[model samples]
Target: MDKLRRVLSGQEENEERGLTSQVLDASSLSYSTRVKWFFICFVAGILLSILGTALLFIPGGGFKLFAVFYTLGNLAALGSTCFLMGPLKQLKRMFEPTRLIATIVMLLCFVLTLCAVFWWDKKPLAILFCVLQFLAMTWYSISYIPFARDAVMKCFTTCLS
Candidate 1:
């Protein structure tokens, strides 16, 4: 944090700093870079979800469970993005992470896929293979890196008083 103190207190000039430095404090981050990772993940999720919609158009065929699950997951995510997240309130951690409203939809998708394979109709070997694809998609969707990056950056601090 001494680097930040240096930058903030003007103990060292901004021209002497490098972009590659890890300690940015609050002022050194550019607006675009600050939010870029979230935007990329958001766009990628949308595109993967559109492919799920296209699967619905196939005739008498495959991926019904997959398409339905993906649709529900995306819609729930979109709703949470709209309603759940607000200006990062550290004091209100207890009011968040409500599964039925936010995270349970994705969990439901995973459980239902496995249940469908077992109880609905385990017809042929070919059917199992197609169902396997759905399971893969659900697993991939569920396995996500929730945070973009480390929340804080720290570097050399030997020089500060």
Candidate 2:
């Protein structure tokens, strides 16, 4: 009960601490502040993603621009969640057994998309990787909602049958 009150009031525990703990406490934003920043980052991420998609219509180097912006947007959106759950906790949750594969695949696709666009200069490959990234990100995201993954799988199976 006391801990919950502290959390709700955005106060840290008055426990014995070390330098690292002190630093983290000093840098930690209040709950409301964290939520505000999270919203800002998430909205910017969505806007960037929309702009990137619109850029797909432009000729010559458009795909490259789209890939970069899209990847950055996804990264920003992912990072925004860290504000709600601190970065360490977010990382731990991301690597948990239930979502581990989805997380890894999503990150890998992000890297591959940029590599295909900038290094390989292969528009088709970049597009393919971007599609994969979208799918992976969707899977990873639904993991956070209870039974969402199961529902998605059931829907796909029913469609196939």
Query: Of the candidates shown, which would achieve the greatest TM-score relative to the real structure?
Result: 2
* Tens-digit lDDT track of model 2 for 88-154: 8999999999999999999999999999988988888988988998899899999999999999999
Report lDDT per candidate.
0.45, 0.90
Q: Cα RMSD (Å) per model?
A: 17.3, 5.7
> Looking at model 1, which ten-residue stretch has the lowest summed lDDT?
147-156
TM-scores vs. true structure, each candidate: 0.35, 0.87
Best candidate (score: lDDT): 2
Q: Score candidate 1 by lDDT.
A: 0.45
